[model samples]
Target chain A: MPDTTTQPLVRVIAAKKDYPLGHRIVQALRGVTLDIASHSFVVMQGPSGSGKTTLLNLIGGIDQPTAGSVFVAGQDTSKLGDSELSRFRAQRLGFVFQNFNLIPVLSAAENIEYPLRLNKVPAPEARARALAMLASMGLSEEAHQRPAELSGGQCQRVAVGRALVTRPDLVIADEPTANLDSATGAKIIELMREMRDRLGTTFLISTHDPQVAALAERMLMMRDGLLCDA
Target chain B: MTSWSLAFRNVWRNTRRSSATMIAIALSCAGLMLFGGYIYWAHLAAEIHTVVLSGHLQVFKSGFKAKGSGNPAAYALANYDEIKKLLLADPVLGPKIDLVTGQLMVNGIITSAEQQTSSTFAGVGAFPDEIERVIYWNPYGLTEARQIPANKHLFARKPELDAADPEGITIGEGLARLLEVSGDSRASLELTALTPAGGLPNMLSATVRQTSIRAMEEIDNHLVVMPITMANDLVFPGEPMHVTAVQLLLKHTEDLHTVEQRIDELAREHQLDIEHRSGWDLNPNHERSLNMLDMFFAFSFCIVGVVLVFTIYNTMMMSIVERTREIGAMRTMGVTRHGIVTMFLQESVVLGLFGGLAGVVTGLVAAWCINHSMILYTPPYFNVKAKLELMCLHSPMIIVGSFFSSFTVAMIGAYIPARHASRMEIAEALRH
Candidate 1:
């Protein structure tokens, strides 16, 4: 329902985000505009402190824009209340963190199943789907391993499976491979691109890794707080 | 995984902290239950003690309390037998009445000729069989102090009057000392009473039958108890018997109010001029002591509850801090703020349930041990040492109330921290 053959999966219009750093205000995003089309792998690449993470957060519906509107999966996320936004995210969007923030208490499979549970999927079906996603991530053997027991690359794979398990319309990853070595980071980026191709879901990832940026279907550059190429 | 299952797993994530918090909860709950058991035991002790001393209710001629002390002979009930019969046969009161008997209050001058001693006596004349029932009214079957070695002498059974020895008498230990008499010595004594109608004196001969201890020192110094017929013969001699008060002992203390109301109705219906006093009214000290104990228990419970809340709060706050990034991740997965709060509260309720159950078990065991240990304690203003006991088994409320209170305290303790965790901005939390 979200892929309007002519419309992009995500549309951000001159979005501005500011933070209060002590007494002075730091503007993280300055009138940034972008569109992420359905089934495309888009990378917002910038140097450290260039506001890529902030832009990704706004498009993820996890944070409200300081100004301008963010439309994801055909809904203006800025206008939604906290609870309404949470439901919208559960139904339409997925997120992957820079540090691979898998729940340390849950096993890899359980962590994948968590989002489906939030979506009110029946337990038996959620479990089956989570196991299938785990197999797809090439982590069938690590299904019962907690995040602490998994290597950095394996944990990121599990994280990717969890984000994609719900079959959401948009998967937003903020520096998903930042914590890995260059070689491992390339592999994670490869796995994500493969998942995107297999599922036909749009992905908007923020990263400074050129190896990851090299494989993006479309690459946008950022300088200071605004996108250099629109 | 369900929310509850995740919450359950999260609790054991830090086993040491969870154990410490549960221990605090368990100890507080046990303390409450134990003290509650003690209070329960005290209630039974006070109840039986009051009933043994004065019975459940007493009916006296109207105005007797105000004027009878000066001239009790003039205020004595003239129709004692009719009232006792009416109480025993009344449909409402018949089953509840354990014993209906009369007591005659008489005072006289007594002389011990051999000791060359003379003293005033304040005496009670009661039917022996009924008096014995009141002396031994142990409905709860609490351990009798008479069986305790240290208390055997003080709580020694009040000697029942011998029917054949109508001239027999029972005097207090202090009175016996003052008159230089002893039950073993069988000292003969004389009593002189003045008739109410005339100043004419009537003399009676009596023998010291038994010497017993009374609870209060002043009362022990002037007490005397004898058969009602002997008292009537000495005070009225050839007149129909008159009783100062009619004592009614009930099978259950709870029925005292119902029986008193029925007595009032009986008095009105029969045109009898009478007033009544319940056991609590007659023994005010016991009621006041129990009331003070209740206040102390409430105060102790509040302190326990407050301390427990803080202990759990500190633990919850620490957990929230450690899990900040994980919480943000969960929110990013579309877990709502309400879901976060529910998860934490579920964890706390689980902690409380386990802790409360452990406390109940420990308390019940401790109570059983103490009940069987036979530890003795001397009560306030009493020389005899009675057994210290707790009553948890017979009172389920002690266990249930302590458990629920601890559970509620645990819930409240988690509320503040859980709310703070839920209110955390998802972006800031992810950064942390």
Candidate 2:
């Protein structure tokens, strides 16, 4: 067993989020608490407007809770300044979105190399790592192709490769497979599970697909700004 | 991908927009360059014209500028040959001097006996070959005043005062008109002046050799140019050679100030009462006109620069709006706000380089065409027309400055938009 397995990669405690919408306050999360163990695959399933994304954003350090603290990779995310938060996210957290979010101007391999470049990695090493990641993803032949040239499944795979190429402590994937078809989405989920198993990197995914949820080691649910057991 | 390569690629993401932005940059650069070239032409025109009329520097007896017009005889420097020898042998000025000559300015009554007309006249007496060099000093190959066909008679190529014809005189067209005498070789005239020592009357006679126009109408109406021997004999009768002013033409006009300083030192050493004027100082109107043009150039550059700034700003803003989501992705990947701004500024640098290069090439080509076309223009106070030419090649700073201005304007325009893009809420930008 990995030494990090004993400690959780993420901790959320009584996080409360509220914002004024026009004239009224909308509570997106209310005193929610959670933990995600290192090297574990976790999933949060919720319907639209059920605050799953809001909670994920809180854990991602992109949004702060109104009355709580969240820790990721051993640092209190809410206490970090904007630049520090950016660095924290860049070094410790990875994100996979529903839209794939590939830079259209860059090729598949270049897209995978983007995060490494951000981490101040040298160009030759970054390219080597990106190419290695592409081979591991079984898309080496399509390395030079742009995101537009790739199918929906290949783009999601490239996004996943990009997320894991930096080998961060945790990958926060919100609807990573939403844009792909069922078979493609299943392959993408399988790819992520394989990455987690091989690299010992923790994953916190949000999904509505029960099939994807069935493969998670731990499952949580959110509705009306509160969390519940699956 | 490296940030620079990424930025370069992003600059071309919207080809049409990028091209349009670059075109705006290029047009502004070319326009500024052309205008600067014209200003360069004006500078040269003023310098050469001043040199042609007065040499690079003229040394006058002290107080001549204040009172010499009323009594030039009193202000005339005595022992002209000695002063000329001293000027030619001086350590500081000897090597720099291209030509050293003396002129006698005399005013008296002139009579055209055959025409039965007489008029008060202002006369200049000078060495034929040396004064000819001063009048035809076109170092920059400016349109020669005498060479213009329309000015052929006005600026007759032959020496104005010939040594062979000791009694010959060249008179201004206005003066000849007043005397009712053409530039006929047979036109006879007599001049009368007072001897300096006792105010005794003295007279000399000459035949009209040519009639030419002067730049200033007031001077042209009563002007006479004759050999120095006749002038000295007419004004001082039995005295040695005396000169109202010594004209010094230098090999390089840039040496005028230094030579003037040395002349001042020489004056003090010899205890000679002398004052000097540069070609630039002699032509006040030309200096004022150039100053006005300089002001216009400054105003033009500001207006053009501001417009270019807004143009680049608008272009950058549009690109940023289109790439909001992309910015969010990079931010999430740990790109700092400074990093994001750097990327966009790099794009502007590319725009500046390519656009500036294209603009310089276009400006040069356009300037060459205009210079070759031989377009004609008559400047203010000039009776002869000159070729309208742009001196772009002759002035390199204008090229570099125009290019740099475009680059700087593009950067200024991109800065605000780049900063705005960097400040976008990461999650919100992702949502967009």
Candidate 3:
């Protein structure tokens, strides 16, 4: 449902992923082809084990397609070495996980500042930017709190702030509000849409929640490792 | 936050495990330091014993060691005065020599008139003042040497051969017991020995001054100390004085090899027919003992190293396993494998530094406690019971060496686990 006339921020051509499970090859993704345009709010909706997570992983460069290419921000991710892909991810990509995977040892502000620090931003600027992101998320009161000390919604907001602090070209969120309550989940989706509109950053979110999928500007559904037109 | 601060925080995440690993490293380091301190104490004790008993170097006429045990007078150096003057006049060797004294060895039979007891005696005649200097030179300030017990005050009271008591002799404790002479009893003895001409036996009347427990327990029965003037008079009667060997003491034992080489050159220049020997040459058992201690230290060090490596390895492996999800998150955020490896290594460095410092403090306290304890034991071939002393060499080399050894082993232990964590699959680790 993406506008094919515009240049794509991510291009997947016949991508396939397989897993070896006890003498059987389980296909996680089979011949998935799609193009996501720049600055678009794209949502991937699928049930458990429907290959939506696999597709998101391929786009984020955290994994490689077994049979085809995944191009993100103009670089073919499958051709990059481990270290190069890591640097590529650091410079051009940001990821938000379903579990709100904040580093338990670091505080809210420190967690947000980490990706900026990875991109070689100076410490003072990184700190100021992290504070700004916390204030934007209404998390200024919880900036010094560790992940364990924060509520689930607060932890998820910190994770989202961390993903956007680097000002990356593409942000990938895999069920970013999975652990939050309905009210908290609706608020997170509103906050993310506000962030996308203000920063003009492209977002690719994968989830089974209809609330998350309903807010998508272009939504794609997957079933049995195959994408379906919506 | 910086990588270092993150690593430091991570180290304390599992408080109990980190402490256990640190304790293992600390104990190993302390054990090595304590054993090294003990070995250092033994070296000093043996050095003092050898140098104090025999001079730093001894000079004898050629063939004296091999054949002069029988009939020492035949190989005696009649030019004792000339050799002494020449040694004192040489600018190169004179300043290094602390003292040069002569000794005349005599084998004779002693008869106590009071007890009517006869015993074989091996006699050494020496200058009273010079002998006192050799015996009382306490450079290391040893407690035992500084305070001689009353019962063993024979050498402490009158180490010198008195010229006034012309025939005065210091007899061994065993010899005095055989004669049944108490410490307060004044007894007269007659000494008889073969004349230098190998003719009839010559006799000298003497009085016992004091009894001593000589160098070894076995030698106490046959030891006798007399004045060189009296021994010469009894041996040569009308001939000039002669001494079997000239003993040379140096200002420092480290100067032995240098002085020996110079002495060799001096002997070559003067055309003197003399052979020189060092203190270690006379006491090879001390060297052998030190070598054995060195081997023991090496064996202990290997054991400690192996145990410490495994302890640190197990700790780091657990840390890696516990933080699998965190590692995956960090990798997703663009942290390179090298960066992850470096972070873990930074944690290891902190742990090693803290453990090494604690070990040094603990070792020092233990050494101090052992040193203050007045434990006593008689070593092999020693007549007196020596006080056990532990002296930690306050050398920076030892402390720094121990610290770095523990630190390096810790780093090596962390290296493998860190690499494995860095190379982990991000997707799999996230699931974990």
List chain B TM-scores, each candidate. 0.93, 0.93, 0.89
Candidate scoring better on TM-score of 1 and 2: 1
lDDT of 2 by residue, B326-369 (tens): 89888888888998899999999988888899999999999999
* Tens-digit per-residue lDDT, A149-180, candidate 3: 99999999999899998888899998988888
Off by over 4 Å in 1: A1-6, B108-121, B177-183, B189-195, B199-203, B214-218
Docking class for candidate 3: medium
lDDT of 1 by residue, A1-230 (tens): 34466667788899999989999999999999888888899988888898988888898887888999888877899888989989988888888888999999999999999999999999999999999999988899999999999999999999999999999898898988889999999999999889898998788888888888888889988889999973
User: Clashing pairs in model 3?
Assistant: B128-B160, B128-B161
Q: Give the TM-score of candidate 3.
A: 0.90
lDDT of 2 at B116: 92
lDDT of 3: 0.83
> How close to the true structure is residue A37 of candidate 1, measured as C-alpha lDDT?
82
Model 2: how many Å of interface RMSD?
A: 1.0
